[model samples]
Target chain A: MQGAITIEGVDKRYISRGRETVALDSVSLNIQPGELVSFVGPSGCGKSTLMNMIAGIVPMTNGRIIHNGKKVSGINRDVGYMTQADSVLPWRTVEKNVALPLEYRGVRTQERKQRVDEMLKLVELEGFNKSFPRELSGGMRKRVALAQMLAYSPNTLLLDEPFGALDAQLKMVMQQQLLNIWREQKKTIVLVTHDLSEAIAVSNRVVVLSGRPGRIKHIENIDIPHPRDVFKVRFLPEFERAYDSLWEQLSSEITKGESL
Target chain B: MQVDESAAVGTGLNTGGSSKAVLAYEAGLEQRKMMVRVSQVLFAIVFLSFWQWASGRIIDPFFVSSPLAVGGRLYEWTLNGQLWSHLSVTMLATAFGFFIGAGIGFALGLLFGKFAFLAEVMDPFITALYSIPKLALAPLFIIWFGIGIESKIAVSASIVFFVVFLNTFAGVRDVSQIYIHSTQIMGASNWAVLRTVVIPSATAWVITGLKVSVPYALVGTVIGEFMSSNRGIGYIIAQATGLFDTNSVFAGIVILMVVGAIINGLLKKTEGWLLRWKE
Candidate 1:
């Protein structure tokens, strides 16, 4: 596909107080256009670092990333990013916050409202357009954040554990909603999450990374068909095999990661 | 303490248990409000009557003016229109100084907040100047702007500038880094980030700064008038002091207190309106 992202031999290092910390080492991956891929790993595995690089918000220590056909540079505005923390502007109402990306794109006022209204409906937040971020529940706020990310119709999405903070039931609901949206929009999504079941439920492929100075431990294909029910996916035989194999690799890394 | 409805019903204290509890709680609240009102009125009456008695007895009336004398002086000023003439001058000076100082301070504060390197370079100088009492600059202002309201405006602006500057600076600096990042990811330019995120976040702090500096602005105006002015409330107080007219001084002080209280109440109302979203 034309809008594919190729991450080649990317490495990231952090230097603070005369100390060196290697966050990612010789990491490489290829994400096809319209594919939903999850980077599943233990904490400190540099999943977030990889997401940042893809978004072009952070510089890598070495190697490069190609977005669409161009080399990724400062702030790849072609992609939408959703972080673990709800980053909705508290001062803005729901509709206004969601319309931010559209506003940044210089979309006109009337068009912005129409687009925001549609997005709010998609997220089931039609009536909450005037409510401030502080007034919304956690799930509702996450919906707003998701709506914000999708507002500008970006070609790709870089989600760094966007639903990690949610409870299990909410997470499942969000996953189902995300799947529904993905089916409709068909944008390339690169998700960073430590939740193994979450990776299997939503993503077509799960890339498992090792501990600190993270390396690709394994990449598993989840053959579960689209329009899959997230609530019932775990009961499937295909899902069981995918889970067992991925968990076997991930648990070892988790133990090793914890020791560090 | 509240008794839960189901628990109270189980104990058979009252069949309409929850409603009764709610009624009792509401009654208690009303009783408290009445008590507060009674105490306030009683305290005011007792204090004013004691001051009316003590001014000429325990304390010399020449030093501490009696309440009755102060009241009479206020009545005399009101009847002759002297109070309005002096009060208008002070109010005009204070309003001019407050707006001008607060405006300039807000503008520069936003500029400095966005440009950290510039703020850092000017930090020591700004702090040094801010530390010096604004009243000390009154004579210099008088020399530059003369004894008119211009001098008072300059002095009040100087005082208000630092208060607002410090508040706006801290508010802008303290905006969450995550929020900024999120805005940028949505393809926002630096200017867009400031407009949508920084300004709104810092508004509360800026308003707080404005509210806090109101009294200081008044102080600067009064001090300027006290130094040298032909007409103002401060002039009235200065004149009373010169003549040892304690009652006039007391009246001037009471007038100032009333003005300050009204201004403070208005400011609080404005703050509540602006930050209503926070609730």
Candidate 2:
């Protein structure tokens, strides 16, 4: 019950320039505790919007989100959200950025340093502790971002295309690293991504959503065994079958979205 | 640029002076630095010599004021300690005005940035006030604040206010929504987010505004002094102009240039130290 998230009949409506825009409508989903679920959809699919609502960064217009049996309102401190863009503070060093959540929770300096050091080692950024974010490469910065998100040990993570900016090889490595961490911690994860293969490779369940006013179109269970080698997962027959089915559902929605 | 393999290898070595190549590279660099200094001195000498030679032949020495005459005036002012007193007075006015103006500007900028309705309501008035040539209001400031350092301070403060305010406002407004949302989701309260994220993010812009407004601050002080003042470099220049002492006028101008350059250099150093993380 620690990481269960129940999004019930959530709708998001935005009024911009006197025009009402329905971003998400009747989007209900139940995520089991410690489940790794990926939301795959086209652009403007309200995937990120749903993630924001679940994190309580944005409000749900019509319904509610419950996490761990408690209703989530403004600024859900129970979950950590890794944004698509680089959220690493340019002014802060890697250690400082990772230590931010701990500092917010009033963790003592000595304990904070220990945890930050451990997190840095986990992310393979141990030597770059004092280096500022601006001095880091894109992949290194992504690692720093991951370390920051995972530092305080949040029970749930909402990742929005976290590795979208990374190159193919680095993305695979990061995906593997993420899987390693998720397997160990068993934290509930909700990832919103445009890449269908990525969704299939990492998540236990891939939720495909339709275009604007986004609603769940299909949910596919990826029954691939644990300890997935993200680098070689595509070679597996089950992986191929899941990819084909998920691609079929996602591509049709994408085409429908395009025609509109 | 040629890739000097020996120099590159020399740079890679952690051992001190084990390689002859590093010594050669160091020597080359030293020579280049020396050459640059020599060129700079040579350029100054040529320019000053030309000015001295052309003073009487090409232009009227009385109007132009030869370099020697300007130097003589500078020495006389320095010997009498008038230069130090005037420079110190101007610096004090500039410093006080800059701090007060920048502080208020930064505070209001944050307030207006957070509240869109307030910014919108006062947008036109702020724009109108900023649009007026600040020097044009010097007479009015002189009247209101009297003919002392206070008038100069008022003038300099007005000049600095808009620059810092506009930059700080833009900096706050331009903070990415993603950063705010991410920080909020990470359990930072509104005040915490403002303190840790918003203010730090706007520091670069605020520093830039301060750097750009430095000359304007100086302008305000000098203009106020020119209009009416008892102790400032601008007062010296005004007095010299009234007496038609062109050499003293040039000398005052030289001191102003030196002061401006020194202030700019100090600002550059501060900016480097503050923004070293950027590198």
Query: By TM-score, who's the top model here?
Result: 1
Residue-by-residue lDDT tens digits, candidate 1, A1-260: 55599989998999989999999999999999999999988898899888888877789999999998889888888888998887998888888999999999899999999999999888877667787877677777888999998889888988898888877887888899999989999989999988888999999999999999899989999999988899999999999999999999999998997776
DockQ for model 1? Answer: 0.35
Candidate 1, residue B25: Cα displacement in angstroms equals 6.2
How far residue A132's Cα lies from its native spot in candidate 2, in Å, is 2.6
Chain B superposition TM-score per model: 0.88, 0.88
In terms of lDDT, model 2 sits at 0.88
Worst 10 residues of 1 chain B by lDDT: B1-10
lDDT of 1 by residue, B6-29 (tens): 232242223554697789999999
Candidate lDDT (C-alpha), each = 0.89, 0.88
**CAPRI classification of candidate 1:** acceptable
User: How would you class the docking of model 2?
Assistant: acceptable
- The true-versus-predicted C-alpha distance at residue A212 of model 2, in Å, is 3.1
B57 Cα displacement, candidate 2 (Å): 3.7
- Regions of candidate 1 where Cα sits further than 4 Å from its true position: A1-3, B1-35
